[model samples]
Target: MSSSSAVKRLLNYAGEKKILLILASIFSFFSTVLMVVPFGSVYFVIRELLTNANDISAIPGDRLILCGWIALGALILGFICLYIGLFFSHFAAYQILYNIRVRLSKHLSTLPLGYFTKGSSGAIKKILDSNVEKIESFTAHQIPDLVSAFLMPLIMIMTMFILDWRLAIATVIPILIGYFIQAAVFSSDSGRKAMEDYQHSLEKMSASGVEYVRGMPAVKVFGMTMDTFLHFKSTIYDFRDWAVSYTKLCRRPYMIYLVMLTSILTFILPVGVFILSGQPDNQAFALTFLLFLTVAPSLSTPMFQLMYLGGELQKITEGNRRIDAILNEKPIAEPVHPKVASSYDVRFENVSFSYQEKGDQEYKLALKNVSFTAPQGKITALVGPSGGGKSTIASLIPRFWDIEEGKIAIGGVPIQAMATNHLMETVSFVFQEVHLFHDTIEENIRMGNRNPTRQDIISAAKLACCHDFITSLPDGYDTKIGEEGVFLSGGEAQRITIARAILKNAPIIILDEATAFADPENEANIQKGLNALIQNKTVITIAHRLSTIRHADQILVLQDGEMVERGTHSDLLALNGLYKKMWNAHLSSKDWGLQEREVHHHE
Candidate 1:
């Protein structure tokens, strides 16, 4: 989209605060005018001295002192106006940014949970952090500075024309040439491609840097250096190389533009000499020519500033387009007449779901014709090999993605009819990967409930079998996690999440390998926590370690996105179907590990 459209969208977010920006621009415009008063004063003072050049004693000393004082006062007032303008602009910009961020975050909450997969997280963060920051930079700094930059030259050119229209016309020639040169360079296909490529490479490099930091533990364990992270290393090198090449390519053109600006006097000098030669006795004309020399070249700085701001505005507007992408994204549609689920039995009937669909090269269903009943107050375990629709089944209960064809219901009511908040309140999730905020342990647990007492937090932690461990820390529940705080082990972190779920105590629980990362001891402890959590709740769990779900009320064995075999543990084994084969394989894996250890011990 065009830059104006992008900027207009940002101003929409500014809402009523648009007034502050206007005020800022007005004040800055006046400030810019006042700032040039000192220069104007210099012109008058010089002309006065030159008029008395034949007799230095006839110089207007009083008038000269008044002019200097006026210059100083105008300079001081200009700075004051500048400060006020900056204050208003910054305050308005910050408020607008805060509103946009909050609105964007709330919108994100309404999107499908699966929309925030691990791979897309970096891009999302950039949109929120740096991309959002871009709009603020454009509005707060650039616009006001552009006002100043724009006005300075216009004011100087006007003053120049008043002094000597000939010199003023000459002064504008180099500026116009410089402007065309900048416009030509900036509007080039190669120039645009260079900027796009630079941004693309920078994002890649940033994402790689984040990945490297995240995988540092693995790298450290493997005794790997920065060079060992070849993808990251390559991205860094690529960014550096591209920057160097782009700079080298643009160097000559930019240098030429700078020459045109710095050599503004060269264009006006010959013209000035010609004018002076025509009026040899006009000492007043000579002084005015000298004043043009001083004032005209100074305009170049602001002219160059305006050009630079224009280029930066393009980049920021591009970033604003990304910000708009998120803002424009439609949130998950809410039901017109929202329904509530009185009973929490999750049923999936004739369900067909797929991440890939039409237009995708691979359109394989993750779940197809999968029907199951996870009855209330009983644990229904989904057991299968990887990619067999086990986790997909668990996720579907919470409506992460609407199925192409299915009747998914909670309490016999279609889930699509349920209000999003109602559906969320009805279900609690404990996935394989645990997420805890960088806050105190108490605060982390309190996220499950809007308002929980310290005692409530401790009580929930105790039920999840993490209270003892938490209390053992120096600060107890007050202890923080992640940054500036202690990091928990996989087991410990999982227990913390379990504690959060217990605190939430939703009637429906979806567990996707809740104990996947735990050690045997931790797994046993996690199971104890899960026991307390799933009591009299509709528990639909996905597990690879079939033994963990051996005593589940029901077992659904899936393969290739279809339910192949399903029954109670013993009943499935007796059928001698896929479930039985999986059970045997599970048993063999344990024996194989034991046998390998025994062989190693013998050796």
Candidate 2:
């Protein structure tokens, strides 16, 4: 964060459109003095047509119509100062890229949802849409062509040293040796490590083309053809062979800065016409033909506007270093004096956890000195088996990922003292991959109470039985739901995510296996919409279906992460052990599915 503090945070996002970028840099410095005053007006109209060819018939006709109206008003004032300096440099680069995408989307809505599970919704959608459109192509076109490429080469080398200080010291020694050989071939750290290895092979070919178009329907329902899309066609041919070997290694220092700027403008305008034709001062040969026609088109117009803003200033310094690594990350702990509880229970006292990941540092507890509670208004259940930590104790009762050593309360305060949006507005989860948003099943059940109406989203989609297939589709609750809803069915997207956790009447739900992937008649209509959204709330439930927590009032179990066994369901099936071998293997698989449906109802 110091290349002069990343160029002063890209000039403080163009200092909030600093008066239309200082009136587009004063109309790009009077449009580079009307485009280098047409190379000193075609070198004084070819040195007055070769020194007034025998007084060109006594020079009159109103001075040849005042030199054709000052050469058509200097080509219409150099096309109206280059169209008002490219219309105020693209209106101050789209108002500083719409205020850095609204301050990085309001700093990603105050961060901390475990910073989006440590990145990768295609690498945070390629850092919020192609790295904030490469900082809006460097503030709307390479920062006004890098401030008119250093003010048109320092106003054409101070008007070529006031027109002939020995032909501006022989045209600034081959334009400073072709700008130090194009700045040693574009400041090579092997050409910025070949443009950061062609932007990490184009962000790993856009995160393997968004994981091969979202795993193309599970790679065509598992057949996985086209050679399993050969790692997304070899990462788009290794980003087209590293963009043709970084455009042939940037065309050898751009053809050696165009042959050292055409051999220093053809050897300083023929050695300033043999030292101004042995000048006896004919006004120093008309000021060395108007400073060699304003230093020969201001020597490649500021090195072609700094080589056309060197790839938008390297994608605006890699989009302000990926929006300053998500506005300087950190945030997770939060909560100072917060507290807002009003009845949800939860609690996990001598708790401990782990999981860390990125460049590890030894942390894998996944729950250790575990303790439990769940209480306030009933149903607990937890069971275990697979990895046993039971969904990391329901993701630490909503702190998502926290508990390193102890406390995790709720009704008795300490969820780090509360406010993580007041403990996710009194918790409520569901999970087992439900999602749902391509909008409108009453706006995804009014995103759990945005101002839910239309009869409170049809009474929370009729208490999550999903209002008879959402009023039988066809734009019932304004249909839509395509993307994540993918036209429903995993028991209608888990009863539209249990009618968005029963319109987020959140008092503390959790769920996790949420009827695992229902189907016994959508798990008896999702166990009657989870008994009308868990009647007294503070539920919990994790169940790998030991008959859906057989009316759980308390259970526990776990294994690797500790809590050996606890209560209910005939007191853990009268202590036979691991919840009576998981409730006698779910009542011997529901008594062989009711004896094969009573032998198919007697055939």
**Worst lDDT 10-window in candidate 2:** 593-602
Encode model 1's per-residue lDDT on 210-274: one tens digit a residue: 88889999999999889988999999999999899889867777787888889889988999999
Count of clashing pairs, candidate 2: 0
Q: By how many angstroms RMSD does model 1 differ from the true structure?
A: 2.8
What TM-score fits each model? 0.93, 0.41
> Candidate 2 residues 513-569, lDDT tens each?
777777789878877887788788888888897876777889899888888888888
Q: What lDDT would each prediction earn against the true structure?
A: 0.85, 0.74
Q: Which residue runs does candidate 1 get wrong by more than 4 Å?
A: 1-10, 55-58, 137-141, 278-285, 482-485, 594-603
How many residue pairs clash in each candidate at the backbone level?
0, 0
